[model samples]
Target: MNISRRALCGVALLAAVNPLGIHALASPSAPKIRVGVLKFGTVNWELDTIKHNKFDAANGIEVEVVYFAGEDATNVAMLAGDLDVIVSDWLWVSRQRSEGEDLTLAPYSTAVGAIMVKNVSPIRGIPDLVGKKIGVAGGSLDKSWLLIQGLARRDHGIDLGKEGDVVFGAPPLLSEKALSGELDAVLNFWHFCARLEANGFRRLIGADDAAKALGASGPVSALGYVFREKWADENPDAAMSFVKASAQAKKLLDESDAEWRRLAPVVRAEGGELEVLRDRYREGIPKRPLAEEERDAAKLYEILAELGGEKLVGEARQMAPGTFWAALKT
Candidate 1:
């Protein structure tokens, strides 16, 4: 779907307040950064932290949180100028740039999902998944699913999608099915995978490991902060401040268990599940240098292109230049 600067798309949603009291507008003195987040996305944990602790105010901006139901809604809200920023994959940014859109992405998280199986399941590797039911979240062309397919093809010459009985559904539903023994294995989002681990599921393989086998340098940022390039150029200070505040929020989350305790209900996890989510989230914080990340991202994009084909990448055979914001702090 080609989107011009003025034209946007849509999805519907309802809103709810997080435990942290939300400040919807900038104070009379501070510049505002309108951020659109999925109503229940993991990104909200950090956004909530930033707002609750006044990190944005400290960094010289106010972050006004807007809620969206899905990526399409966030993309639309962003293009319509209702939001200054949103979290999205760099591939989408690359495709938009290739199509002549002036957009860029800042690294967010490297938390790719994993392939999981029941603790007693016989599936030990990609090959063992043959003839078993595999539940996949994010549909057929899901990036993690595609990576596992690429790895399977590269290493064992089998297409799991064709060999296994594949089931696609929402993450929560799939997680439930996997737990109930209705599915023999699952490839799901990281948080869901982490939850499964807490519930006795063993990871068969991680997307990051599959990516490494296919030549990615290390953990790749599957999602990031995306925004119009013009906005960043015009409001350089606010842009930089948001980045700094985002980093500070991540540092805090990484260091303080008390903060996680505060965020527990927000993420809807507790006991072992909450611990798994916290540890996995902290481990996902992007640590690779930007240049190295960019290179690895480019490599991963090529592999993804081979696996997902044109429908996924939308006309770019390679990741476009300037796909990642060049000004990220080292």
Candidate 2:
């Protein structure tokens, strides 16, 4: 499912109904948390689940979801206090913390990503990627791209950028290029990978594979819900309520295919594509929020440092303390 289309649908729906206006007229009995989200991202599904199921209302908070066109826009809004929370990666959380932003992360999903190729292609593993044209979804500094680069060097003795021709673009474009034979394989975000597989591509390796090779104790989710420290501090109960609602939605995704089906329109998936997406969501959902020590921020810093060098994380091999928002667990 191309997430952008679904995001547009969400925006259109929001515009038509004026959810914010409706919320304003409702009884001002509950606290409100304004959440920033992307129009065409996976976060939309989870947020929609929470809204439709009235999870936030059940938890005594009025959830207001604000939409953005891209990450930069969402980041700016969050920084400007226009949003109380947003879905983002740990790297961004770390970078923000390094700059003294006092943002914290709670696990959203652990399903990192995967590299995919045509089923008939002879590229059976990452090792076989040498000298091949590979498509990457994000930019050169994208965390998954860097992790794959690091893993290729550490586990396969290959520097993918120097040894293989890497082309970076949007996930949908990468998938199109790979399918058209312009690239041998593509490393894409999980949702894009699921869409490609539904269209006949095959997974060569997953980000979890790279993490395992990097010595993680278990699966580590790179994405999470990020919020300002001050906001969380002032509204601790509301923050926990948000986390609890999100966790409930995650559980529903993990346990019920019916829930996925129910969310099909929100995610823009149907039939076999819906099933593939459901399976991917199940595979990516984290079992729990990461503990402070369990986050392994140091190892991630090392991987980013190795692949992206000073350009990504500067001279640091460890992120600032309080990056993982461990209080959610407590």
Candidate 3:
């Protein structure tokens, strides 16, 4: 397999502005942190790399990981007292809080999602989606897709709740149906999106552009690190340590090219063309969480509350007063 020019350019761009520091791996520590994550994507890569390379260990921390195929599985495990940390979407935290589900926004992970449709589908834009059937990965915490739909509803005065106007399904079905021309669109996470595109599905719109249209100031992040409320309350020190360690990993990628290349595949796996996946990794992942971006999360919550026909926005206290660990510095 050969790398794309865009991927090559992406690698070069990342090398020029490496803000996440990639230092020498740290030594192993005891009582490893247990984290449950979605399987075999960029996020899985990050968690696995951190565990295998002893990135947490180097910082005097230990990490244990569990993998699941879907966000619902991770949420179910978290609710069952089986996980210390889980990687999920930010909007999910808000919706969960609004519904009185117990969880907290631990940290921002990544800000991207993708919309896939048959390469020849008539759906060319958001407005084109009226009366069309679309699929979403059921129980996916990646609410950016829903957020985009909500924004479209608000801005265009359209209603998706009406029968036959919109439909939702899991990622596998989304892929299968779209390929078979049974769907107008499918919303999926990053790596899945890349694979779908490679399979000839055209991207109708992406979270990045959707966020902007909805008035987001900077790039929007979707996935976040979340911890159960009880677990966090009992393990504040561990929580802080976890936050700091993850931030350090982000910093490593921000600063070191050699480190980014080594870690990029952990996010996006390429069969043989490592460069293409590496390029996608560099451009797609956010180096670290930003506090200022919490406003977007807040805004997303407000939108969901309205769409969900709720009275009050969920508690802000649930989200860490500081969005990212480093933000607490000021």
Highest TM-score against the true fold, candidate: 1
Structural similarity to truth (TM-score) of each candidate: 0.91, 0.89, 0.70
Query: Mind giving the per-residue lDDT tens digits that candidate 2 earns over 110-129?
Result: 77778899988999988899
Q: Report the candidate with higher lDDT, 2 versus 3.
A: 2
Estimate the Cα RMSD of every predicted model relative to the unseen true structure: 7.8, 7.8, 8.9
TM-score for candidate 3, please give it: 0.70
Off by over 4 Å in 1: 1-27
* Residue-level error in angstroms, candidate 1, position 103: 1.3
Off by over 4 Å in 2: 1-27
Worst 10 residues of 1 by lDDT: 7-16
Evaluated against the true structure, the overall lDDT of model 2 is 0.78
In candidate 3, what are the lDDT values of residues 1-330, reduced to their tens digit? 122335433433443355242222222233456888767646665565555544554444467788788767988888777887887666556556656666766554453667778787777877777778877764323455556767677677655445224556756667788777777787776656766776777778877776667666766566668776666555554555566556555655544667656655564544433444444455655543465567666665555555544333344424333333332334
Arrange candidates, best TM-score first.
1, 2, 3
| Pairs clashing within candidate 1 | none
lDDT of 1 by residue, 77-109 (tens): 777788899999988899889998888988999
Least lDDT summed over 10 consecutive residues: which range in candidate 2? 1-10
